[model samples]
Target: MPTNGSQAGSKKEFQYRTQFPPDFDDEGESSGYVGFEHIVGTLIWASSQASLNLFEASNTVEAVTLERHFTVNSAPDNWQPPVDIWAQISFSWPVENSTLSLYGDEALCDLYHSETTHCRHQPLTANIVTELEIVYMFSERLVSHLDSDEGIEKTAR
Candidate 1:
């Protein structure tokens, strides 16, 4: 189960170990190489916001399927137990003779760039909800808005 704010090891230091290919260079490839720390941090922050109540009640979406399939714990009334939230990561690999192409890279870059450019708050807005949260109107007919702009904005339909 995932948690919001202080719980769910959000304050804990994140550590990861990487194993490179057998022919990969060690020292030369190590320094001056930047990793996806910000992206990973953003994802972890986003998971904390993926509340079932927010998804089901506030967003007006049927989440029974998500609850049934992904939830390992079902004690919603009890705040003692954190509600289960799932974050799925799918990777694309090159086929036998083909090369791998990451088309999503451009999309991610665009999103991050938009967040930086358009969002009023710089980095904190990436994690916590503020007035800077970018809101997208999917359809003019679908005119449901939260009474308060306290929760994270839904960027997609």
Candidate 2:
């Protein structure tokens, strides 16, 4: 383990663990972590930490209300349209002169090439991206939340 700053000539150090602040995600199972300490060798699996970092950075209040509405079918080949988990993240925000709808072209791609044909890999990707989109929507809202002065805060309530 190494410290970011040198405290002594002997190199006093500490190992840092990634922590997602409470200001964003809360009360969600598997919030952004997939608990994959055993997954090894695969490129994305090896880069799990970086993937988690990207997910944490997208923490917007929009995340808490994100609803996972999707359909998945794995009866046949795993490479095609309408991925096993075709997810939709529903969110509305007042930005600039209009509202925003986040899920438009985030359709899933091939799982065969990625070696994600296994239920574990495919489901994790779908779930993670769905959540990631929710987080990104919040970052996007910042631009519009500042510009909107009048409108309706309509939702699926």
Candidate 3:
């Protein structure tokens, strides 16, 4: 879960580690990314950056905006424990491959170019919902970290 804003009416979202292979020549790469519309976030009792950007939730039933709000604690034994357990991520159908459809809301489809921006908030009208789904539109990459105290400290850094 991520830390909420300092004040009410304020909002924040998570930024998952969706870096890159920069290019993908097909061949399904199994290890990278979160949906752009989904927001991944983290939290702390006080202010500290150990909290990692995990995943996010959709804003509406249609998920017009990214809103991942939840909480996780900084306990040693539980990768992320909660003084009280909270939801860290909100997911949708897994991403498929990249290809834009022109028949839908062209503007939003156009606006979301990157992996995260590929989807947007829609009215959730009957016509807007679909039985279809799309893939990541991009390839997934691998991420690695050294397992040690230094690695833990680096997460904060």
Root-mean-square deviation of every model = 20.3, 22.5, 20.4
Tens-digit lDDT track for model 2 on 27-46?
23221222111111121232
The residue pairs that clash in candidate 2, if any, are: 72-84, 95-144
For candidate 2, what is the TM-score? 0.14
Off by over 4 Å in 3: 1-33, 36-66, 78-107, 110-157
**TM-score on alpha carbons, each prediction:** 0.17, 0.14, 0.17
lDDT of 3 by residue, 56-151 (tens): 324333344332223222323333422222333223332221111112222333344532342434322112212222223111221122233443
Model 3 misses residue 72 by how many Å?
A: 0.9
Q: In candidate 1, what are the lDDT values of residues 1-157, reduced to their tens digit?
A: 1112212322221232233322233323211222232223333344444542222211121244321111111122323423333223321111210110112122233434542344333223111111212232232222343334556766866
- Relative to the true structure, candidate 1 has a C-alpha RMSD (angstroms) of 20.3
**Which of the two candidates, 2 or 3, achieves a greater lDDT against the reference?**
3
Q: What is the lDDT of every predicted structure here?
A: 0.26, 0.25, 0.27
Q: Which of candidates 1 and 2 is the stronger one according to lDDT?
A: 1
Ranking by lDDT: 3, 1, 2
